[model samples]
Target: MAQNDTFNALLLQEGDPRPIAEVSTLNPADLPAGEVLVAVEHSGLNYKDAMILNGLGRLVREYPHVPGIDLAGTVTESSDARYRPGDHVLLTGWHVGERYWGGFAEYARVHGDWLTPMPDTLDARGAMIVGTAGFTAMLAIEALEHGEITPGTGEILVTGASGGVGNLAIALLAALGYRVVAATGRPENARHLEALGARSIVPRGELAERPDRPLLSERWAGVIDSVGGDTLAHALAETQARGVVAACGLAGGAGLTTTVIPFLLRGIRLQGIDSVQYPATDRERVWQRIGDLLPTEVLERCLAKEVGLSQLPQRAEALLAGQIRGRVLVTPTDH
Candidate 1:
C-alpha cells in the first residue's frame, strides 16, 4: 500500500531447486497480466502445493513462482465486465499457480474466467480453509452420488483420510449419514479422523499391494480416494458389488494394477476425480453443495495449523512425511 514498500511472499526459484520462503516484497506494477487483480487474504496448502515448493514434481514449470493453487480475496481492480472493485471472489485450478503467479503473494492477478464469487456463506479465511482440496472432495462426492451412491448402500471408504481432501470427504459423507471408514498411513492420525466422524480408521499398509484375489470381501459402497497406487486397486477389489471409488491423488503411486473381476463381474466403478478445468456450471454446483453440507465448526476444526508463507519449507516436508493432520492454511498477506 506504500511506495517502495513491498509485501512479503514465499518465492520458489526453479534453478535453486530449494524453496527460499523468506520475507520478500512485491510491487503491484510487476504483477502478471490478468483481467482482475485481487488483494489475497488467505491461501491453503495442498499436496500439490507441497510438490511445487519442494520441486519434487514438475508443477511450477517456472522460476521465482508463487506456488499457491487456491486463494480467496476481494477484488481491488477489475478490467472485466464480470467483476468490479469491492467484489469478493475465489479461484482454484486452471493453471493459475503453475503457469502464472499465484496467491502465495499478497496480490494475485488472475484471469476473469478462473475466478468465482465468494459465496455469502464463506468469508476469505473460510474460503481458503475449504480451498481446492475441499472443493475436490465435494467433486468426488458428487461423482459418487451421480453414480447412485447413497447412505443406504453401505459404508464408504476414504483413502488418505488425514489429507485435506480425505478429511473433508470423511466429514461430508458422515454428515450425510453414510458410514465412513478412513484410511491413513499415519496411525497417529486415527484420533483426528475419528473426531471428524470417521466411523473407523485403519492403517494404510493393509491396502498397499495388489489383492491376492481379483475380488475380495465386499466392504464399501463408495470410496473417496486421494491415494492412487495399489491402494486404489485394492479399494476397487474390496469394494462391494456395484460400488464406486472416486480416485483422485497419486500419493502412494500412480500405477494401478488390477483385473476386470471387480468391474465386469462385480459391477464396481473406479471413478476418476479431476478438479482442474471443470465446467463452470459443475464448479458452481459443487461450491453450492459445499456451502450447504460443510458446517462452520467442522471446517474450523479441520484446520490443523496456520503458517506464514516463510514457513512453507518445513510445512512441505511435514506433509510429504505424513507427519501432519487436518488442513493447513497459509496466510500470505495477513499476520
Candidate 2:
C-alpha cells in the first residue's frame, strides 16, 4: 500500500462521559512520528485495551487514538539501522496504546527501539496469539525460577486462571513439568482450563475472599497472580515457605489489605511484573523463549476469538465484564 492510501483503524474520539470508539480511515501520513512503519497483521485484545476502548482508567489523554497494546507484523519502512523494510516484528509495552498511536490500525509507526524482531518460530498470527498476556506470563515464570521455585517444589497456583495470562501460564508451567492449579470464578471452564495443562481447578471463592487470618495452610510453591486485592492476600497467606508470587494484573482490584506476616514468617516473596516498559533489550530473548516453550497446539487453543476493528467496542465491554475467557485477536484490516 502506498503511504497516501487509506487504511482502516479503530479510532477513539472524546465523548460526553466516555470516549466513542469507531472504525475510521487514515493514511500513513496521519500516524505519529516514529522511526519504523509496520503493516500490522494482528493485534491482541488486552485488559488495558479494554480500558482504553471504553475510556476507562484515563489511559488515553488524547482523542482520535488507537488502542491496541500489542501487535505482530512486518516492517514497511524504517529510518533506523536496527530494523529494515520487510523484517518481521512484534511490539508490546512502552505505552503505545495509551500515550501514542498503537496497532488498532492496519498500519502503525513506532520507535525502532520499541520493536522486537519476531522470532522465526512464530509467524505474525502465532506471535499475536502469544501477545502481551503470554509475554507477561513468561516474565512471571522467570521471576519464579529466579526465586528458586521448581516443578518438584510443589503445586504452582495460577489465579484468574481462565484469562489470557493465567491460561498461558498454566500451559507453560505444565510444559516445564510443574503441576499447575488454576483458580477461576467460572467453574464451567474447568474442563477447558484442565485441557490447557492445569492439573486441577480451584474455585475463585477459595481465594477471592479476604483472609480471615494472617496465615493459612501452606499450598502453592509459587503463584502467578493476575488478580490482586483479596486474591493476592489469600495467596500470600497460603504460600509455602520461601515461595514466590509474581503479581502482574489488577483485574480483581488493586488494594492490598494483608499483613506482612507471610513475608516475615514464611519468607514469601511478592514480585511485581511490569510488562509495559519492560526493557526492550530483554524482549527478543523472552519472545524466543515463549516460542520455544509454548507448544503450537496449546497456543492455538488459547485463542478465544478473532474480531475486526469495528467489533472492538462491544468486545471491550465483554472483556471488562470478565466474560472473555482467553486471548482475543484483532484483525485491523478486516473492517
Candidate 3:
C-alpha cells in the first residue's frame, strides 16, 4: 500500500505531562471512520484545548488523541456528495478533540454533519485565525444585537476583555458603533485593548471587587460577559434597565451568585451563549458575518502568537495561566 506523509498534532496520554504532538508517516489505516478527510492547514489554540493538553480537564476522555477544537483546510476525499475534493472547509466544536479526533493533526477526518464548507472568500489560515474563540465572540455579539444594543444604550461592558473571546467582542461591538468598556486584570494590556476599539478600560480589580448589592449604579446598557461567577453577577447588578448580557465562558468561575433584582425589577435579560453545539446553519451565518466583519486589521489585533505544533505544550500552560492574550494560531507545517 502506498503511504503518505503523516502530519503532527498535539496528543496527551492518559497520565503524561509535557506531551508533544509527533509527526509520523501515515497510511490509510490511521484515519477515523468518516465520510470526509481534509488536509488541515491551520488550527486554533483555545482555553479548552489547553485543558486537554495539560490533562487537567475532562475534555479528552481518552488518550493518544489530537487536541484542537478548531481547524480549517481543504477536502481531500469525501463520501458525502455535498462535498468534493479541493473544497475548503472549517470545523468548530462538534465534540471533536474530545470524543473524536480533532484538527490539530495535519489532517482531519470528520463526519459531513460536523463540517461547514468554508465561505468562498476565506482561505484556511484566515479561517483558523477566526476559529472557535472568534466564533464564540461573534455569537455573543449576535445575542447582544438581538437584545437591542443601540447608540442610545450606554456603554457596553466586556469582561475578560483581554482573552480571545473578550477581545474579539470588544472589536466587534465597537465596529457596530457601541462604546465598549474593556475589563482586564492585566493593566499592561490597557492600551492593547483600547487599540482593539475599547472606548474605556476598567481594571479587573475594579470590577471584580464590586460590592455585593441588590443593584449597582447602572453603568452599562449591554455586556458581553466571558468571566462568569461574581464578575457576571456584578455586571448584572449594574446593567441598565432592560439591558441585556450575553454570558459565554466561565473564566472566573462557573457559579453565578446573583440576585433576581436585575431580572425581576430592572427587567434585565441574560442570554447564554454556547458555540460548541450551535446549529450548522446558524454557525454558517455567523461565519459569513465573520468573513465580512472581522477584517484583516481586526484579525491582526487578535492574533497574539503563532507557534508550531511542537511548541503547543508549553503554550498551553501559558494560556491556562491566563498569561497569553488575544488569540494563538497553531500551524502544523511550521515544524
Candidate 4:
C-alpha cells in the first residue's frame, strides 16, 4: 500500500462531555512513528477500550487518537530485524491505546518490541479472540499455580464471570480440571456461564456487599477475581487456608475494604495481575500456552459478538453498562 492510500479507523476526538468516536479515513502517513507497520485484521473490544472510547479515563492524552489495546495482524513493513513483511503477530498492553496510537485502524504502526509473533496454532482472528483478557486470565492461573493451588486442591471462584476475562478464566480453569464457581449479577446468564465450564454459579449480590465479619466460611481453594472492591473482599474472606487470589480487574470498583484476617489466619496470598506491562521476553511462551489452552471451539463458544468500527461507539456504551457478555471482536476492514 502507498503512504497516501487511505484506510478507515475509529478516531476519538475531544467532545464537551465525552469523546466523539467516528469512523474516519486516514493514510499510512497519519499513523504514529514506529519500526513496524502492520495490516490489522482483528482487534478486541476490552473494558479499557470502552473507557477510552467514551473518554471516561484520561487514557489518551491527545485528540484524534486510535483506541484499541489488543490487535492481531500481519506485518506489512518493518525496520526491525525481528519482524518482516508478511509476519503474523499479536500485541497487547504496553499502554498501546492509552499512551500511544493504537490498532482501531485497518493498519497500525507500532514499536517492533511490542509485538509477539503469532503462535502456529493461532491465526489472527483466534489470537484476538484470546486477546488481552485471555492473556490476563492465563497470567492469573500461573500465579495461582505458583502459590501451589492445583486443580485437585478444591473449587475455584471466578468473579465477574460474565465478562471476557472471567469467561476465559472459567473455561481455562475447567479445562485444567478445576471445579469453577462463576459469580455474576445477571442470573439469566447462569446457563451461559455453565456452558463455558462453570461448575456452579454464585449470585453477585451474595458477594457484592461488604463482609459483616472479617472471616467467612472457607470455600474457594483459589480465586481469579476480575471484580475488585466488595467482591474481592468477600472472596478473600471465604478463601480456604493457604489459598491464592489473583486480583485482576476493577469493574466493580478499585477500593478494597477488607481486614488482614484472611492473610494472617488463613495464609491467603493476594496476587495482582498486570498484563499491560508484562515482560516482553516472556510473552511468546505465554502466548503459546494460551493457544494450547484455548482451542478454536472454546474461543467460538466464548465470543459474544463481532462488530465493525462503525458499530463500536454503540457497543462501547453497552459494554460499560454491563449489557455485553463474553468477548467482542472488532473487524477494522468491515467498514
Candidate 5:
C-alpha cells in the first residue's frame, strides 16, 4: 500500500444541496483499518444504496464516502485465519454502505467476520448480481418455508416483481415448484416476469390503492412483499388462512394503514426480514442456497445492465425514481 499506488472509487463529497458522487483516485493505505482487504470487482445497486448515493436518507454518516451495500471479489490481504490473499469472498448488509466505508471502489477493507466465502459456482459478477436484494429474497423464502408454507399449499404473490428481490423471489420459488403470481407496475415486463416463472401478473396500483375493508377476499396463500405500506396491507388482508407474508422493503412507503383483523381472524402472519444482522451461520446457509437455486440463465435475465463506478450517480437517480428494472451491477475497474 504505497502512497503512490492509486485505485478508483466513487467518492461522495458534501455539497450545499446534496452529496455528490465523483470518480476519484485513492491509496489502499487510506482504507479503514480492518483484518481483510478485498479487491472489489463488482457491487450491486439497491434502494438503500440509491438513498445513500443521492443523500436522500441520512444513510451515510460521513462525507467522502463510498456507497455500495453489496460487493464480491478476491481478498488481497487478510490477517484473520478464516481468510487469506486470493480468497474469493462477498459481503452484504452489516451497514457497510450506510455507516462504514463501502464497496463502490476498487478496494474495500472489512472485518473478516463480515466476509462470506463466495459460492463456488458463481463468479464475482454473478454473486454481485444476486447481491443484497437477492440475499434478502432467499431469506424471505426461507422464512416462508419455516412458517410451513409449502409449494403446493397455494399461490405466492410477489409484489414489486420487476425489481431485484421480487424477480429473484419469483425465480427461486418457481424453481422450488411453487406457483407464483407477480405484481408489478410495469406491464411491459409481464413477459419477463412470466419467463421467470410467474403464472400471472397483477398491476401494482391495484394493491397500492387502499382497500375499503380490513379483510379482502382470500386469494394469496402467501406473499413475498418488497413494497410496504398500502401494498403490504392489501396483501395481508387478501392472504388465506394460515398464510405467511415476508415483508422486506419499503419502496412504496413506510406507513401501514391496516387493522389487526387479518392477523386475529385469518391467522395470517407477517414476517419481517432483516438481512443486516442475520447470523453468520445462517448467512452462509442462505448464500449457499442462493448459489444452488439461481441458475445462470435466470441470473442473466435479472441483469438490467452492467455499469462502472462513474455511471453510478445517474443510475442511482433512476433507481430512486422507479425508472430502472431488475439489478444493476457496478464494475469498479471499468474504463
Candidate 6:
C-alpha cells in the first residue's frame, strides 16, 4: 500500500531523439530495491547526467529510467541500521544514474552503502551544489597531495576549467594556496573562473590540439584534468618532473594520444580519478574537507542555474551543447 504512493519524478523513456525525460508521478515500489529511501531535496546535473538525459551514451540500458547522478536529501526510511529517518545524506557515483534508478525524483531508494552522512556544516542544498563534480575535484586534490604535489610545487593546471569539476577544482586548489591556471575554451568565462580563484587563464585551444612532440617544456607541477583525450596528452607532456595528473573526465575526448616519455623520463604520475565506488570512509573524509575548504559563499557562486524537474530537459540539451557553465541544481519538488 505504501509502495503504491505516488510522487513526481523526471522519467526518462527510450525514444527516437534519444532518452526522453518528462515529469511523471512514480510509485515508491517502482524504485529499485535498496536499503534506504530518501526524500530527495536536491539533485545536480553533471556531464554524465546530461549524457543519460540525452541518451548520448546509452548510459541507461532500460526505458523509463530516472537519471540523476548526484543527490542530497533526508532519509525517510532505512533497512540498514547505519541510517534512519531524519538523517541527511548525499549520494554520488556508484553507477547510480546509469545502472540504477536515480535521484531525478522527489524520492530515491538506494543502497545504504552508497550514502554518505552529510557533514554538519553542509545542508542538503549546499551538498547538492557541490554534488558529484566537487566531490570528484576533492578526490583529485587528495590524489595530488598524496602524490607529494604540494601547493608550492608549482602552478596547477586545471583543464576544462569552466565545467563543474574544473570550477570546483579551481576553488578548492586556490583555497588550499595553489596557483591555478584554468584552461578554458571560453575566454569569455575568464573573469568568472578567476572569481572562483584561478590565478590565471589559458586558452583551452592551447591544450586541445595534439602537440607534435611527446613532451614539451615543463609548465605545471600538477594538474586536475577533466577534459581528457588530446588535452590529457598535452597536460602529460607539459607537467614538471614527478608531477601528478589526476584524470577525471572525457569531456573533450576519451583517447589519450601520448608516449611513455612523460612517465619514464619525467616520472610523471597519471592518476585516474574515479568518484564512483570511492570508499565510504574516504568519501566522508573528502566531504568533510570539502565543507571545510569550500565556504558557503564559494559554493553558492559555483551554482550557475537552479531548475525544477520540468526544466531539466532544456538544461540537459544546453549542457550537451556546451552552452551552460558551472553547476546546475535540479529541484524536483519545485516542479
* Higher-ranked by lDDT: 3 or 6: 6
Please write out the lDDT profile of model 4 over residues 1-335, one tens digit for every residue: 79779999999889977899889999988999999999999999999999988888788889879889999999999999999899999999999989998888899999999999999989999988889999999999999999999989999999999999998998899888899999999999999899889999999999899999999999999999998999999999999999999999999999999999999999999999999999999999999988888789999988999999999988989989999899999999996
* Reference-based lDDT, residue 275, model 3: 91
The models' CA-based lDDT, in order, is: 0.84, 0.92, 0.83, 0.93, 0.90, 0.91
Q: Which residue window of length 10 is worst by lDDT in model 6?
A: 55-64
Residue-by-residue lDDT tens digits, candidate 1, 175-207:
788889998888888888898899898788898
lDDT of 5 by residue, 1-335 (tens): 45588999988998756797799989977788889999999999998998887788687778878778999999988899999899999999899988888899999999998999988778898898899999999989988999899998999999999998998899889999999999999999999999999999999988988789999999998999999999999999999999999999999999999999999998998999999999988777788888888888899999998999988889988988888889999899993
lDDT, model 4? 0.93
For residues 1-335, could you state the per-residue lDDT of candidate 6 as single tens digits?
28768999999888987876789988877888999999999999999988887778667888778889999999999989999899999999899989998888999999999999999889999899899999999999999999999988999999988889998999999999999999999899999999999989999888888889988999999999998999999899999999999999999888888899999999999999989889877788889999999889999989999999999888988987777889999899999
lDDT of model 6 at residue 224?
95
Q: Could you tell me every candidate's TM-score relative to the true structure?
A: 0.95, 0.98, 0.95, 0.99, 0.98, 0.97
After TM-score superposition, what is the CA distance of residue 103 in candidate 1 from its true location, in Å? 0.7
In candidate 1, stretches whose alpha carbon ends up further than 4 angstroms from where it belongs are 1-5, 16-20
After superposition, the stretches of candidate 3 with alpha carbons farther than 4 Å from their true spots are: 1-5, 16-26
Off by over 4 Å in 5: 1-3
TM-score of candidate 2 versus the correct structure, residues matched by position: 0.98
**lDDT of model 2, residue 62:** 85
For 94-174, candidate 3 gives per-residue lDDT tens digits of 889889988777877889999988876577777887888888888888877788778667899999988998888887787
* CA displacement after TM-score superposition, residue 34 of candidate 2 (Å): 0.5
> Could you tell which candidate, 3 or 6, scores higher by TM-score?
6
The alpha-carbon lDDT assigned to residue 221 of candidate 1 equals 92
- RMSD (Å) per prediction: 1.6, 0.9, 1.8, 0.8, 0.9, 1.2
- Choose 2 or 3, whichever is better by TM-score: 2
Position 126, candidate 5: lDDT: 86
- Over all chains combined, what TM-score does candidate 1 have? 0.95
